[model samples]
Every structure is written in C-alpha cells, then in structure tokens.
Target: MIPFSLLDYVALFWYITFWLCFSWVVDHSRLKHHNLSHLMNGHRLRWMRNMSTRDLRMVDTAIISGLQNGTAFFASTSLLAIGGGFAMLNSTERAIQLFSDLSIPVETTRALWEVKVLFLILIYVYAFFKFGWAYRLFNYSSILIGALPYAKTADEQELEIAIRQAAEFNSLAGKHFNLGLRSFFFSLALFGWFVHPGLLIVTTTFVGLVLIRRQYFSRSQTLSMHLLPEKE
Candidate 1:
C-alpha cells in the first residue's frame, strides 16, 4: 500500500498535469481548423484574393509552425516540473525548513506544508493563464501575417507598410509566449529552492539549458522559425 504522504504528492502531481493537459487540448483545438486569410486580415476570401501565392504560403506556414513548436515546449516544461516536484516530496520536512529559512515568515512555519501546497496551486494557475494567453497571441500573429501584401503588388509602398505591420504584430505575440515560458521558471526555482539550495541552482541552470536546447537543437523549434523569426 502506498503511504498517505506519497499519495498526497501524487495528487498534487496529477493536479498540475491536469491543467497542463487542459491547456494543450485548448491550444490544439484552436490550431486545428485555422482560416488563414480571414484570421490574418480580418477580411473575407474576396479581400485576400489579390495576394500572391508566395505571400499566402508564408502566412499558412507561420500559423502551423508556431502552434507545433509552442505545444512541444509547453509539454516539456510541464513534465519537468512534475518530475521535480515528486522528487522534492520525498523529503518534505527538510524542504519546508529550507523554504522557511529563505524568506517565508516564522508565523507560517507551523503551516509551511500548507503554504507549499498553496504555492503549487498558484504556480499551476499562473502557468495555465500565461500559456493560454500566448496561444491566443500566436493566433493573432497568424492573422497579422496573412494581412501583409504580396511582393508582386504594384504598390511597393503598400507592401513595405504591410511587412512592417506584420513584423511588429508577430513580435508582440512572440514576446508574450516567450515571457509566459519564463514565468514558469520562477515557480520551478522556488519549489526546488526549499528542497536544497544547491539543487535549486542546478535545476535553474538545467532549465536554461533545456530552453536553449529546445530553441536551437529541437526540430520543432527549428520549424517554428517559419512562423516567428528565430531570436539572436
């Protein structure tokens, strides 16, 4: 029989997983049936009929690339947090002590365990909100991409203006998604901090490495450049 303490950790782990999965479903559902022209330009097919094939293809690729890579990154981080939390639960008291020593109030010491639980709850909530918002912003970015004019347009001036608009809009949406992912690290660092300061630092470093690897080495992120330009 599993111990009740272990069960508690299991429950918390599942709770976090539930939210992450829920966000994934929501994200994928939004991505699956996208209407490129209407979404990008907020105009019907008639309005976008003037765009060149090359311009239309660029818009379609951007939407598909962003969703695929964003989903993979979200899944990876959620899994890491779940695994790390489980490991920390094995030494609950020590973890609590480490957290309390850092900055948590003494009056809350008796209720440290509860505080930790609350912190976990907050982390999950924050993560979901950020991820969900990013998904929406990416969707908006796709629409903006479609709104850009094709290179063959007679009006070179109009094409330049459209390109700038698309770039700015895509950049805005990309920032939100990237910032959302960074916010996850804040909670990750805190949870691990209470477990062991050294481990906390190590985990933090690993988190950075994982992000770098995903952005640079992961095939999914490589593909995402089709939607949002790769960062320097």
Candidate 2:
C-alpha cells in the first residue's frame, strides 16, 4: 500500500467538506430569491394546485410516473457503474500500466489503487440509495394523488390538505433525486484525485463553481422565474 501523504489526506478532507457545505448551502440557504431549486419548488406547489381543480387526473399521474421512471433509470445506472468499478479493481495492474503509459505521474500502489476504486464505488452506492429512495417517495406521492377526493366531492379545505400532502412528497422526492445527480457530478471531480492532490483541489473548486452558477445564475433559472405568475 502506498501510504497517502499529508497532502492527499488534506485534499480528501477538503473535497468532502466542500461538497457537504455546498449541498447544505444550495438546499438550506434561502439567501437567493430565484435559484433553480426554489423556482422548481414553486412550480411543484402550483402543479398540485392545478391538479386540485382538474376533473381528469391522468396528467398528474403521468408526471409522477415520469419522475419515478427517471429515478429508476439513474439508480440502475449507478448499479452498473458500481459493477464497472469492481471490474477495474480486478484489473488494477493493467490500469496502473495504462496510466503509466499515458504519462500520468500518479504515485499509486496496488492497495492505494484499490482504495481509490473503492471510494468511487461507495459514491455510486450512495447515489443508488438516494435514487432508489426517491423512486419510492414518488410512488408514495402517486398514491397520495390517487387518494385525493374527486373534484365534485371534495370540499375546498379537503382539496387543499391533499394537495399540500402530495406536493410535499413530490418535493422531497425531487430533492433526493437532485442529490443523487449531484453525487454523479462530484464523482467526475473525484477522478482528479487519482491524478494528483493538487489537481483534485483544482477540479473540486471548478466543479463547485460550476454547480453554484447553475443553481443560482443559469439561464434555466431565469426562464423558470419568467414563467412565474406576476403578483397583483
């Protein structure tokens, strides 16, 4: 095992800490008024409200089905990625030789390479769990939608309660799905660590900046805000 240098340890620590802080800031911080997530949350609520008024709920069900399908797809992809990671671990000798031939100056022993591959596997495992749970939450949201009283029979208050319940579950599912996607993005950045600690720090910082921009300043956020109804 090639023992990790102090710099390697520091790089790994910073990568994990930054990821956690970034996720918390994006999901919990309300400093921004019209970030991508906030805008989508508003739309989720509006969608529930619109469904409450409709007699035919096929559209709402179809949307929920779509969400479930997307989550399932990602979960399956994560599983495949995990299997590939194991396959790479079994061929570490060839991988190390390939990196050497490519002139990548990474100082990796067999044990260290295995550890790196294991780290990658753990990341995909985390994503798979997140995606799987999100799929289940979407299913629960669908059931909630179905349980909602028919438009003709439901009182306004009853409809409001059902809509709120369904919307909350839908929002929670979306949050988990987003987290899974974020893991996928960060995994790409993690590949830099296999090259060098310095490169890892640089890639991590770059990825963080890109994610922050997409969340708060992207054109999609602008378009979503534009679609919102104006206040009186």
Candidate 3:
C-alpha cells in the first residue's frame, strides 16, 4: 500500500476548510446579502407574494414544475455518478496498470487509487442526498403554493404566513440544490488527487475561487442584481 503523506492530509483538510467556510459565508454571513443567492431569494419571496394575488396561477405552477424537473435531473445525475465511482473501484487494478504505462509520473498504487475512488463515491453520496431532499422541498413548496388563498379573500396576516412558508420552502430547495452543485464542483477537484496531492490543493483552490467569483462578482450576479428593485 502506498502510505499517505503529511501533505496529502493537509490538502484534504484545506479542501474541507474552504468548502465549509465558503458555504457559511455565502449562506449565513452578513456578506450573504451581496451574494447572488440572496438576490434570487428575494425574487422567490416576491414570486410567492405575487402568486397570492393571482387567481389563474398556471404560470406559477409551471415555474414550480420546472424547478422540480431540474432538481430531479440533478438527483438522477448524482446517482449515476455514484455508480460510476463504484465501477472505478472495481477497475482499480486495471486503471493502475494503464496509468503506470504512461510517460507522465502518476501515482499508480492500488490502495491509493482505491482511497481516491472511495472518497469520490462519498462525495456523490452526499450530493445525492442533498438533491433528494431538495426535490422533496420543492414538492412541498408546490403543495403550499396550491394552498395559498386568493389574495382577494385571504386575511392579510394569514396570507402573509402562507406566502412566507411557500417562499421559504422554495428558497430552501434552491439552497440544497446549490450545495449539491458545489459537491459536483469539488468532486472535479478530487480528480487532481489521482495525479498528486499538490495538484489536489491547486485544483481545490481554483474551484473555490471560481465559486466565489460566480457567486459574488460574476456578470450573472450583475444581471440578478438588476432584477431586484432595491439593494438588499
């Protein structure tokens, strides 16, 4: 078995640290208001509120249907990825043999390759559960949407509570879906571990930076900001 090195441990730790910190900052920190998720969440709240005012809500239901379809797609993709990971484990010996013949220096130890494959499987498992739960949340949100009374007949306070519930469920579903996508991004970084621990660090950092940029500084964020009527 190829023994794990101290640098490998450090790289894994850094990957976890960055993922956790980035998630917290994006979801809970004061700076979150500046993130695209926060902006989109406001949109969600508005959508639920506006939905209450409408008697013909086919459009709103259609939007929820779209969201559910997207979440189900991701959930299915995560399952496929997990199956692929297990297949990789089954082929580790052949994979190591194939890599050893390559000119580039590659770590070709069976145990090390197995460990990497197992970690990849675990990441996919995490993502699958996240997506699964997100799909359920979206389902619940749709039910809540149907429960929403026409604004013309609803008591103001009761309608406010119902709208909030629908919006919160929708937002929560989106949050979990984003997290599953984050796992997908980090799983790409996990690919670097197949070559070298140092490369793992480099790839993880690149993924983290890309996520930050897209959330906080990308042109998409600018477009999202334009959708909001006022600053959060």
- Global Cα lDDT for candidate 2: 0.88
lDDT of 3 by residue, 8-115 (tens): 898889988988999999999999998998889988988988899999999999999999999899999999999999999999889998889989898757888888
Worst 10 residues of 2 by lDDT: 29-38
Which scores better on TM-score, 1 or 3?
3
* Backbone clashes in model 3, listed as residue pairs: none
Q: If the candidates were sorted by their TM-score against the true structure, best first, what order would they fall in?
A: 3, 2, 1
The CA lDDT of each predicted structure is 0.51, 0.88, 0.92
After superposition, candidate 3 runs with Cα above 4 Å error: none
The residue-by-residue lDDT of candidate 1 on 1-232, one tens digit each, is 3223443465445534544543343234454122221133222222233343364475565554766478457746665665555555556677556756776343223344545645665565566566666666666656765666666753878765665565555544544555566557545645553343444445555665565455445665444434532232
**Which residue runs of candidate 1 sit more than 4 Å off their true CA positions?**
1-59, 62-110, 197-232
For candidate 1, what is the lDDT?
0.51
lDDT tens string, model 2, 51-140? 877889999998898989999999999999999999989999998888788755767778888888899999999999999999999999
Indicate the TM-score of model 3.
Answer: 0.96
Please give the RMSD of candidate 2 to the true structure.
1.9
- Each candidate's clash count: 3, 0, 0
